[model samples]
Target chain A: MNPERMYDALDRITRVRGVRGAMVVSAEDGLVVGEAVMEGVRGNAVAALAASLAARLGRAAGAAEAGAQRFVHLQAEVGAMLLMPGADGLVIVAVTDQHVNVGLVRLEMQRMVEDIA
Target chain B: MKARVVEPWLLAPVERFVRESGARLTMVMTPSGQVLAQYGFTRAVDVMSAAALGAGIAASTGEIVRMLDEPDFRVLNHQSAQHGIFLGRFDSRRGPLLGLVVYGEDTSIGLVQLFFEDFVADLEEAAPAETPRGPVLAADFERDLNESLATLFR
Candidate 1:
């Protein structure tokens, strides 16, 4: 995986308005390899949960004949999570508020994944 | 957690979402990681893991909101060279439901979004969610974890 490019992608996500934090995680085994965050956001916890979710969903997706799991996003009353598979076993996760522009985030994340994968 | 066959009326739309979106897999589950209905998952363990993680992230985000006093986040989307995924929540009479879609080179995120909205509407109408359940007990967690691990290996 391209470490430099990963940092760049994470930087862009963190810069978005309402985004609390972002991290690069290992999809195979839940772990955060790299991260960036704004105040009040816990990068470690986000990475662990995001990575686990992606991994879990990836397996289900595979069984359902859905092919390889690619992207994951979670929305709630309070916030949201965006996860993208990166180079090797790495997955990128971003935490954002309700107001964040999802279209723009997806577009950038798409490019970032391409660069790192 | 448990798995249910998302109401029969909702199957048509769910099927349509996969067929039209060219998505390989899709899942409608609870925030706490319980599978309501799933497409393309061959193993139960995988579904178990997905639901747990999806719900875990949602729950963890809630923690962030409690600490910061800001509104919670919404809508999460991710993409890779070969696949794309989208996760979102919508309320039903039952409560809140999480929708997850995974697509590959054959489709785009825009297409997935289009179908996901349709699926959500159908889901709400057919499966009016019940009141949310309480937290999973510690003992249940351990038992569930062991079961999922065994399934993953097999």
Candidate 2:
């Protein structure tokens, strides 16, 4: 995968409100195919973890009758993680601070997922 | 390794999930990447690799959310030419369990996601009520692996 192109997409998301980091990951192996992550946070780990959580949540969505699970937003007390499908069996994971404008970030990422693909 | 004592009850939901979703294979593991129950994987190493990667990805993403002051990310879907994959979590009285599924033309992600919710709820009800949620012991890894393999292979 092209890290530069992935970085460009991630870079745009990171510019959004409360966005901290972003990366492209392989869903199959939980490895970082590319990243535009920031300091103090491990992008590799994020890619790997997001891969697992996304898979599990996808399964959960399936079992729950939630449908394709194209997008996932995990809200925690601290912040949130958002995942979207990208080109070629890849996922885009974004980290944002609590109270971030989630709606806007999601919209931007949604576009980015397509753009990157 | 994701370690835990093997219980017979865990298999029920897993089996149901496979049949209900028309998955070619299914694996129920831990957040730490240990296979608690698996169906469709031909090799033990495949399970091990998947579990490890699953656990690592879960941990990493969970931490990222926490770092950004968020709580969690719930589900993920992957599509390709040959097949599709679904992964997510379920809570039992014992602890949280991870599920991985692979399906081909026989099923779609929507069907799998729809059924996954029911599987989790059923699993929650079926889990032994007395077992408090906590970490699995490392010492039991080998024994747990052996027992689970024995059951699957049988």
Candidate 3:
């Protein structure tokens, strides 16, 4: 996808209430394709961690005889991470607060993935 | 892969970096091409050759940056179809150190760079106080080089 479109998608996701950042990252290499992050958010670090986690989850799914992972949600004390795997080894990641609307974020992320594919 | 370091303090940080980054090959050296630690090298000759080339590249690039009147780049990366090479510089109590890494398709530059930041911090924290050393004579240079190589490979 074009850079403009990618940024637009990330912007839309980050506009969600409680979302700290959104990024398009490469699942294989953990590099940021594009991002819309708030100040103090380390985009590269988030991309790396999200990609690594998605890759490991993909492996675990394969081992369990499950199909490719469509979505992943990781919850922590203060924040949460949501990932949506897309085609061409790309993944969409959202860093959000604990109170963020997970359903809304997931819906937008799915739309972004579909747009990429 | 096991990491060998000429300085005992380097062993822990280098080994941790190799394990976390999944780098196929790594070499930690000074700007003057003196090897401090290395991993994934079987031959002494290869280690010397790589150290020389890595230091040369850093020097030439640094000069180029000076000519352009730009700030020195923190890291240099060369990505190919099959592998990627990363060379980064970090400061420690001893002096500036250079880390050269070669990684394959299994790992990405982002991951390597991410772990590299931690590695540099660990090294900086672990580095001992620098000791004064006499200048190397032409005759002793080769001997010192060979001894360092022996320590790394052994």
Candidate 4:
């Protein structure tokens, strides 16, 4: 995958309305391979959290129907965590305002995932 | 072959079940935001986007209550005069969260949870043996719902 281009795409995405920042992480390692955002947003924490969340969601759940999870979203009153798959060993992370146009954000994030993949 | 490619086969049935359950939108996701599949509403505003928002809530909530011995999730079910939003956690290959939104007042919480549980079981049992072939995208699984949602909301 083109790391540099991915960073550019993330920067552009996070710049959209209500987006605070974005990160590109290695889902397997929980490592913050790249990040772009405002102050106070911990890139590492986001990466680790995303990785952990991915692991928890991707590993195995008894109730999970017979299929792979397409994506996971954790919503908070303050903000939201947006996780989308990247190429092997990677995931796209976005922290956005609760009121942001979620549809637009999702489309952009999905577009980015496709581009990176 | 990219084993993880997202495809419609993984999403169609889930969508049908969600709509049949009376939810305006239903999203099957990983705990982190990877979308397993979705049903109901297709527009950009459909469940796929909402799952992104909801999954974040589940994770943050899961972290805070883990101290209290809650099992890694905070199911948020809010009911009022107008609408209801029910959130719960489900584990597949990876344990993901499921969110269901009822547009109008539909207080059958028991039914909602049961429906979710049933689908989760089906997903686990029916999971494709070979890893999917392609980098999975949320849209691939959410196409019908996205279209439906757009039509409804518009």
Candidate 5:
């Protein structure tokens, strides 16, 4: 998938009421897909870390007798991380603060996942 | 045998904490698409009814990740101009998530985090006998996959 398209989606998520920044990355190689990140926030580190987390979760779920993992999320003290598997080898990530509505975020992401897939 | 079932008692208390703190909603979902429990404001639609919605959210928008020393702690907090949310991993200690959501008006996020720690403790203290049932088993999933494989084999 095009990084530009992913970035556009990230930008929308960041624009949501309480989001601080948003990013998209390739979880396969830990590469930055597109980033509209904040200064204090390390966008690359976030990408790599998100990729790693997604990879682990993916592996764990695949190994489970159940099925594959749909996605992975990590939350910090002030901000949060959202990782979404994309078409081919990409993953989408969003970093936001506490004001984001979990329901809205989920709805929006489900739409994005369909787009990426 | 199925793994021991998990109780969602944490939903009531955590929801109370989030609503009392003015948070719009709170939810906990497994890495997979299983939504364990959710409390707070939700649309009448069934979208908010499922548990894996959290994983769906995470996969949709990849973002900030903080690795805590304690295991089983995956938290995602996002803020919109009008609302705010904090979603985290189920606190293994408390048998549910140590999550708290606050919305409307600018809140002291730092202070809310402090309260999260306390809320976690409270959940642990109020641990119930069983957690909610995990995600559903898609009975047709394996059959579908097998059918696809059979076509390729032919």
Candidate 6:
């Protein structure tokens, strides 16, 4: 996808309340394809960690005959991470605070993935 | 795989990095091409060749960055379908150290880079105070190189 469109997608995701950042990352190598993050967020680190987790989860799912992973949510004490696997080895990742509206965020991310596909 | 280091202090950090990063091959050397530690290389010739090429790439790229008047790049990566190579530079008590890592599809560059930060920190903490050595003379160059290689492979 074009850079502008990629950013637009991320912008829409980050527009949701409590989302610190959003990124399009390569699941294979954890490299950032595009991102829209706040000033203090570490986009590179988040992209890397998200890709790693997605790959591991995908493998685990395959091993268990569970088919492909549709979504991943990791909740921590202070914040949360949400991942939506997309076509062509791409993943849409969103970092959010604990108060984030998970339902809305997931809905928007699903839309973004469909758009990319 | 086990990592062998010429300097004792490098052993723990290099070994940890090797295990954590899942790198198929790795080498730690000075910017001038002196090998300090290595993992997963069976042949001495391959080690020396990789060291030479890695140092050369770092030097040439550093010069290119200088020409552009840009800040030095922290890490350089090249990825293909099945494997990736990561070259990073870190500052230690002795001086600048370069790390070259080759990883397969089992691991990604992001994981390697993420662990490399911890490796650098461990190395910095473990490195002993610098002890100056006499400049390498033409006659001693070959002997020193062979000895270092022997230490690594032995």
Best by DockQ: 3
lDDT of 3: 0.91
Native contacts matched by each model? 0.00, 0.00, 0.67, 0.00, 0.00, 0.67
Models sorted by TM-score, best on top: 3, 6, 2, 1, 4, 5
- Kindly list the per-residue Cα lDDT of model 1 for residues B11-110, writing each as its tens digit: 6667776776667877776676656577777777677777777777677766886689876645677777777777777776667778777787555554
Predicted candidate 6 versus true structure: per-residue lDDT over A58-85, tens digit per residue: 9999999999899999999999999999
> Can you list each candidate's DockQ?
0.03, 0.03, 0.72, 0.01, 0.02, 0.69
Runs in model 4 deviating more than 4 A are: A1-117, B1-6, B45-49, B94-97, B130-154
Give the per-residue Cα lDDT of candidate 3 at A69.
96
lDDT digits (tens) for residues A4-106 of candidate 2: 7667777888888788887777776566777676697777656656776777888889899989778888999988999987778788888988978988888
Q: List candidate 2 segments past 4 Å from native.
A: A1-117, B1-6, B132-138
RMSD of each: 14.5, 12.8, 1.9, 21.9, 20.3, 2.0
The TM-scores, chain A only, for the candidates as listed are 0.90, 0.90, 0.97, 0.90, 0.84, 0.96
Tell me the spans in candidate 3 whose CA falls farther than 4 Å from its real position.
B133-137
Better of 2 and 6 by TM-score: 6
Candidate 5 chain B, which ten residues in sequence have the lowest lDDT sum? Answer: B1-10
Instruction: Give per-residue CA lDDT, model 4, range B1-154, as digits (tens).
Output: 0111134445545654565445665665556555555545444444446767787788787888887886767467776677667777766554344554554433244345545556667777666555544644667646644444443344
Candidate 5 residue lDDT tens string, B43-99 = 323323333455555544333332333333355676667765655554454244333
DockQ, computed on Cα atoms, for candidate 2: 0.03
**iRMS of candidate 6, Å:** 1.0
Q: What is the per-residue lDDT of model 3 for residues A8-28, given as tens digits with 9 covering 90 to 100?
A: 888889989999999999888
lDDT of 4 by residue, A13-105 (tens): 887899998888877546677889789887766676577677667755425764665677789988898888777878888898888777777
